[model samples]
Target chain A: MTNDHHIRTRLRDKIVGIAGCGGLGSNCAVALARVGVGRLVIADFDKVEVSNLNRQYFFADQVGMPKVTALRTNIHRIDKDIMVDSHELILNPDNIPEVFNDCDVIVEAFDSAEMKLMIVETVTEKMPGKPLVCGVGLAGWGENNDIGMKVFDNVYICGDHLREVSPDFPPIAPRVGIVANMEANQVLEILLGKMNDGNNTQ
Target chain B: MEITLNNRKETIPDGDITVADLIRFKNFTFRLLVTKVNGRLVKKEARDQVYIREGDDVTVLHLISGG
Candidate 1:
């Protein structure tokens, strides 16, 4: 197949499940839709707030709306042809397989440390064969440039080294966008089997 | 000398190396976000002058919230 055909065929009908429809999740959903990932499964139990307006793509009208629903709306607005399954709930062991069984990749976007760790550990255990890319530190205003992925076989963590001494940084969309897109790209690379260097490449 | 990292137990040279000294050696500046240490949470002011032991576990977690 030609290079163009190869790329298209690689992405066609691929299913990616995104956990957390906040900044990282929302932006990743949009990026995947634009990239023609075919179907997307996005989940989040929260809603957009006024504080999220600074960096999130959602508008004031969507402030009270469930993040999953709003993300579904955003994806639909971007590409109606894309199939998105939106879940307004948290991801846990009980539903991980059911929610992500058909997914080619899983994107973790939980904001809280405990939640992120829980999701990461649970997903890693439940779906050892599937690929996962988690979003990590995109904190601070002017100091968020290091975006990369840590690939351990099929599990990947994107962002910066998440240690307490790291810093008290804030989230910005442009910065989040960079890491989210990189996560999405890593998903694509995994699908293409070009993810051999997934770990240190970040 | 050894310094604690993310709370994971590591054997390092015993000395007065502070957490700041360890972070600098890693080429990590003062802007990255850290969330947890040794599987526990750490505050901002404790980033420096936190004396580490040879076998102490030090975990560093960054604050990551989406846009």
Candidate 2:
């Protein structure tokens, strides 16, 4: 039962912000907390519902709870010491800056295409050099090989650029989980890699 | 002029086309676009002002989806 004492200590001071508490954000938050990220700023305007259970992290009992609050409670179950600051409201271009300005890296886990575009545009424009791990398209199934990443300076986009979820192509658990965890992995790589080799000006 | 776009070689019919024109000509309507010219980030506002040159390495990626 040995823990990653050294890795944990290194990550204990870092903060990660998640822009949505849906399939991508909730799971990424859990993964980051497990790896010892010290603080989290989670924002979501919606409440947990039965429909989201297929991919999101909320328990059946937690339905009707605001996504941000529900995710914070679930994260605490993994590690109570982790600090969580949750905002339960819609995130437009205006409030995003005030809410996530201090996070070391921001996770864009929104469901709508408009919100996704807005987050990327706003974060890259306003935050300047902040690292953003964003999920693009993981709708339907069986294109595992196609699920790769693209880099645009500070933003890392994971998932196929095509395929938006619709009535015909809905998001499922496995694909969502894979991309969500990929975002988490990117967060750690950015954080720990920076720690290991200082900042490499890109 | 020919340019490397998203790793593929593409020929742009216009001689002096900006990033905004390329996006419109290519019909890439997705708003979640991130454009890079020779590794330098070109913000959304500057896309119309940034021009694409021959042999330039350009990347216009639809980094997210609306769904």
Candidate 3:
């Protein structure tokens, strides 16, 4: 079989899942939408608040709306043909598999440390073969270019993997957007078979 | 005991060390770490209960979530 090289049609059948709808999740979805990912399964149990506007892909009008729904609407604005399956509920180990089972890749964009750990651990354990692009240690502004990416077998982590968010260093826009798009880029690489497989990887 | 820690060879004086014990022994004070022993994920609650044997492959990733 021959490979499809056309940029627009290559991702026509790909399905990507986003596990959070906050800063990283929203921004990542937008980036993926722009790139024409076929389907996105997004889940979140929160609403878009006014404070989230500083770094999230939500507007003031969408403050009271559920993030998954709002993000879906926004993604449609970019490409109405792109299918978005939005789930508005708290995700746990039990429901995670059912929610994102068919997704080719999953993005972990949770804010709280517990949720981040839960999603990463769950996906890694249950979905052994699928790729999980995650964000960690992305805090503060562009004082330094410490944001980096870590590659494991099935897990790809983006960030410095150290700095924690605090009063002195809050999660800002540019750096967060960078990590979010990095995650989107990772998904593109995985789907396009650009990632280095375990072949001869000793 | 010798084991592969993050792809690097390391020696642990204790032959049998629990995941929690290893974390403490190594001073892994990071609140968020996704640990795996032999490609199997070990959650936070199970760290103390799970033991790392000789020649085990272990990975402990540091992470922070604000977005």
Candidate 2, overall lDDT?
0.85
- In terms of docking quality, model 3 is medium
Candidate 2 lDDT by residue in tens digits, A153-189: 7889888777788778788888888889989988988
Model 3 residue runs over 4 Å out of place are: A1-5, A195-202
> Which candidate has the highest TM-score of all?
3
Model 2: how many Å of interface RMSD?
2.9
How accurate locally, in lDDT, is each candidate?
0.69, 0.85, 0.87
Candidate 1 lDDT, A68-168, residue by residue in tens = 88888888898798888988887777887898889988988776666666665566556765787877767654455465666544557787645221346
Sort the predicted structures by DockQ, highest score first: 3, 2, 1
Q: Against the true structure, what is each candidate's TM-score?
A: 0.69, 0.85, 0.91
Off by over 4 Å in 2: A1-3, A194-202, B1-14, B24-32, B36-50, B53-58, B63-67
**Cα distance off (Å), candidate 2, residue A188:** 0.5
List model 3 lDDT by residue over A61-100, tens digit each: 9989999999999999999999999999999988999999
> DockQ of all candidates, in order?
0.17, 0.42, 0.76
Model 2 Cα displacement at A156 (Å)?
0.1
Candidates ranked by lDDT, best first?
3, 2, 1
